[model samples]
Target: LGRWINPDPGGTIDGLNLFRMVSNNPLTLRDRSGLRGSGYIYVPFLSRDTVDIAIALYTQKYAVNKKPDIVVFSSRNEQLDFYEELKKRRSDFAAAMGKSLFEKYNTSDLSRKSLLNAGVKETEIKSTIMSIGNYLAINSMTLMNQQDDEIFSEISIGDKLKIIGHGSAGSAEISSGGLKSVTLSMHELAERLDFSGLPDQALQITLLPCQSGDELLEPVFIEGKSPFMRTRPSAAESLFYEMQARGYRRVTTAGYRGFGQIRGFLESTGSHHTQRKPNSITASDDIVRRRDAKEIFC
Candidate 1:
């Protein structure tokens, strides 16, 4: 699990790794009107197939303004392994998948025309188009794996939080002053930390293997639905509702997940590895937080 500031927050070309879940395009400009202020982006990695790496841009119409935050959670080693495999297969995979996607969803001509009208350089337009194709191919692959356990989960936030109460099993809460983080192990289970105290700031939350199971559990409140509640809120929804109750008006989440097995190959190829105590879960505070995409990608 990791989190970082989106170098291009609210920009159209952000969240490339999340190409699996969100279309590699900007949210409709019309929808942008309803945003009250900036929100935090949180990304979680629960399983290989359940990784949905995209930024969750939040805004409120009539609430206290707050800076956006980003959170990511995943099996670190597993995600790294999957990425290594993807890199090895990228060229072949892109070539095979790119054509079909391009033909079906290609907007190159329209995009080029728009860029030309906007006075963008020809080279930049070409580069952007190429990036679009790559993103389309990746999105196609993600759609194919929607049913697979190795795909990432889709997360969204909306106004109003409907809460009932916290469940008794596999739940924990960590609170410091008015800020709180919760871990819920139900329906695929997830861990979330709230930073209502810090406005317009970004922080990363990494969950180590040692932090898994009952040891990570703490008593916490779980929101429930009322008689009018027809749909169950997802983990993200529940967390957003909880945050709003704590006086936060905006939120966002984004990140990627692992897909293939390549860790062993990397290890054999002389990749540096870190050693940790057996079955020991590292405390959340001790986990290093990445500050930018460069650090994460490099």
Candidate 2:
């Protein structure tokens, strides 16, 4: 886990002694960087059909020697589409904040002491504050549109579900489900899934659907009005907040902004669609993917 030079002090310099150290079992164990010691889960809802293409693209990208585990599930009802509503809300918030202030918080640095006081790591302060101001803007706007049972869907859990793998980090490639996908909520999956099989350590959650990084107001009432203007900017933020709120310290969540896709491939079917900001203005698929692939963590 330390400096990954040759594990053997004395051996032929063939450049692959670490793989030999793990006995070639990188599935349950990995010596690589980024998310070391953490396996990934790629869960795709079965009904979308188009999501399969995205899954294939993802599998090709991430499935090297240590292949990601795939879990196929299905949903009965078509998930609600909240993209337009959220986009409108965000645009309005941006307008209210004005372009200059919006750009400042959205892409610039925040008060270092304030972020550190909020318990952000020193190294992550700069990166973490990029969207905190956007989240704050959306959170303020969402307070006016509060309603009963607004945080979760009334629909019952879907049937014909099959869960597999024990990945410390999960990437659910949701297509139909907006934020509160009908197939499953972030809380529902975390609570229902049996993650006890994994090592007793932190877990990371990722939602791969478009606009999964947008903000949503939390549904908690106090004296007929929500006390704290709490909001979840993405599925990952929701999971991270839930984990911390429910006293699970060792969990983190991440989601992509604008349109998310696996690099270098067209994941969508022939059905034509467009967005105000498609993550990137570039025309190339790979460039769009790279630009669109910015993840907002919580």
Task: Identify the leading candidate in terms of lDDT.
Answer: 2
The residue ranges of model 2 lying beyond 4 angstroms of the native Cα positions read 1-39, 50-54, 62-181, 194-200, 216-232, 263-293, 296-298
- Give the 10-residue window scoring lowest on summed lDDT in candidate 1: 55-64
User: What is the C-alpha lDDT profile of model 2 across 171-264, one tens digit per residue?
Assistant: 2323343343445556665553323222212344555455555565555668976477666456556655655655654334555455543321
Query: Of the candidates shown, which would achieve the greatest TM-score relative to the real structure?
Result: 2
User: What is the C-alpha local distance difference test score of candidate 2?
Assistant: 0.38
| Residue 260 accuracy (lDDT) in model 1 | 11
- CA lDDT, candidate 1, residue 284: 33
- Per-model TM-score, in order, reads 0.26, 0.39
Model 1 Cα lDDT, one tens digit per residue, 1-298? 1222233332333332322112334343334424332222222333322222221111111111233322222345544554554465456545654565545435444552354345454554444444443343333232111122221233232221111112221133211111233333322222223321233122121221111112222344446833332233232333334545555443432111111111221122232112222232564332222111101110
Model 2 TM: 0.39
